[model samples]
Target: MEPASHGLRESATFDRATIHAIQRAAETGIYDIRGWGAKRRLPHFDDLLLLGASMSRYPLEGYRERCDTDVVLGTRHAKHPLRLSTPVTIAGMSFGALSAQAKEALGRGASEAGTSTTTGDGGMTPEERGHSKHLVYQYLPSRYGMNPDDLRAADAIEVVLGQGAKPGGGGMLLGQKITERVAGMRTLPVGIDQRSACRHPDWTGPDDLAIKILELREITDWEKPIYVKVGATRTYYDVKLAVHAGADVVVVDGMQGGTAATQDVFIEHVGIPTLAALPQAVRALQELGVHREVQLIVSGGIRGGADMAKALALGADAVAIGTAALIALGDNHPKYDAEYRRLGSAAGYFDDYQDGRDPAGISTQDEELAARLDPVDAGRRLANFLRVMTMEAQTLARACGKAHLLHLEPEDLVALTIESAAMARVPLAGTNWIPGAGL
Candidate 1:
């Protein structure tokens, strides 16, 4: 037998996946659309490390010390603000994108964990509202299922200007995921592709947004807090604008944030990373002298307690999770490995949430697939995850000699890479140099 011949290596710049994508696009004459966040890695929390106390700083005794994780959001101009027991909250994942059971599970889990859950593009669901103790209703460009009654029912309202997955682009719910119920909620034809408007139809700029906020406040009788959620791109300006628009809280979602469905190009190419966006958003708030008063919630690529702690250290009042929350609810459980494989993907690798064939039942619309998930069990799992995350964050806070998670500051952190140092605005490990500090 002839020995196997080695061919020339593929170009690192244009790898096999890139070549395949190009070929696919050429053949189909269409852009590749898929679910989830950026596939390419960027600077993230893993690149930063906590500088635990030893000689210079005092460390608290783990067993005897108390490390509070509570956070109050939307205090700037709200008559009633949301006081959460944990600094970690659930980010928005729309009803049309997530199964109703999944929505219920998210609400139950968030409520059980003493945090808050948010509505997404298709607006609020009764299942979610009924289960969530503190629910934040989203006002998106699509405005599907939006009503004054539901708005009044919410504990808070988040006016979503953009999402991290596709910053400038609108939302996409493929035809396959659009069931009759979803169609009814969105007031669209069943099995038809739905593209949410990129911008709000009624409002144009920040001034217009201020008026809308006032209108919402009036409609709700000034009872609910108003939050402005923006995709992280020009975050410094966007956050400033949101605050100026009378938002009680500002949520900045970075590129690593997930979506149920969007063009793959947008997810990979658009928006800034969470580590890069957080400091800018904080700076904007500080510039306006509303850093804490107009609370900031940072999202995107927040995986565990460490990420939450890092966000808090960087001056975010709280952190929000979407992909991580779904994972906690069993979106890609190893138990469903066989089913995932059958769908041309494997557990931990499935990203076809747009197709609505999720084996874990969290992202599907089919009755049998959706029925696979028990909301109670999923909620319990999510609650456990949240508890673990909170505990982990508290552990780090105590190590940094902080009595509360909010007391954690940038001084408690150091970056392992120049990119991370620049993005997180932290000093490099083994050096006092913070890239771009003097600039």
Candidate 2:
């Protein structure tokens, strides 16, 4: 029914989606829970434009000149830092949240692209370790599958303070998705819903975190990099505190960061945008006199090379991707549209990752559905996508007269909107004004 045909106007405050939410709440008496990142529109990388070289600056020839994309992370305190050919990396996605095959595919793709992949919440899997050249083991509060041996085997360790999608909340794995293998890995009952602890049980403050870092360094003989990851809220202080706690690298995840399952309210209401948090994190690092010494990796809504280049220009050493990587592995392919519809969603609109019924096999724990994904083929597709992103970033860097991706500065960028100019700390297009620059 079209409102226009009935000559009726819809309320701006109570839209159709809002009305549906009210109806759902009344029917189920439960708050909505779903997967993916923040769906709300916010200031993002698209609001920033790169200024190509014309008069004062010189642009490099596309085929004749070189623009390096190599990046070295965790050079501050680690004996062996991660030296990658490109700055893009795969973000953490737990073994329980994703199938073993999907984890292996991520490892293969990242390895082929000369980058790193992380072991998310439920701990390291043998398949991922075997396929990945450089793997960062995530140390979450849950301590799901954590072991000293896995810690020693990891190339790097990331201590997760919080996730962007649920800043003050824990992770959720419904009973439907909690298969025997997933339950065993997480040390929980096979058909029971699990919720992780929001904070580390042993540590409460920076001092304890410092001790934890020391323990991790001792466990690994100080050979591996120690990273501290925090959600976008209080990013400046979080970065400062993480560095003070002896972190070798810091990763800031914005509100747009994806999750396997979380409350709808938490996903849309908590944390700031990636564009707004990057500058704050950079300022914190600069103030500590370790701007480049302690690397910064930002994640949230990074989609392509343009977003990656923009993040680098804003002072991030690298960018991590989660949702985009899954898409690359064919999570929402058009061929699965019919199956998606049967599941009450379309290919592009599917976000029910916790249901354990994924048609593409990238997010399910079901045996038959999981087998539908060919890890080898999916890995090749992911590799191709990563290569294209790297090339796109290089193209943008050349146009901006940057000899390397790390050379891209905020000066080469201009904001298309006042909000973006204020958030990105760049000048507005065709003007020298930066909103709230002095404030």
Q: Which candidate gets the maximum lDDT versus the true structure?
A: 2
Q: Give a tens-digit lDDT track for model 1, residues 1-439.
A: 3333555566899988899989999999999777879989899999999999999999998979899988888777777899999999999999889999999999999999999999998988889999999999999998998999999999999999999998889888998889999999899999998989999999999999999999999999888999999999999999999988999999999999999989898999999999999999999999999889999999999999999999999999999999999999998789999998998889889899999989888888998999988999999999999999999999999999999999999989999999999999999999999989989
Q: Write the per-residue lDDT of candidate 2 for residues 261-334, one digit (tens) a residue.
A: 99899999999999999999999999999999999999999999999999999999999999999999998899
Per-candidate Cα lDDT values, in order, are: 0.93, 0.94
Residue pairs in clash, model 1: none
Candidate 2 colliding pairs = none
- Ten consecutive residues with minimal summed lDDT in candidate 2? 163-172
Q: State model 1's lDDT.
A: 0.93
Cα RMSD of all models vs. native, in order, equals: 1.7, 0.9
Q: Please list the residue runs of candidate 2 whose C-alpha ends up more than 4 Å from where it truly belongs after superposition.
A: none
TM-score of each: 0.97, 0.99
lDDT of 2 at 62: 92
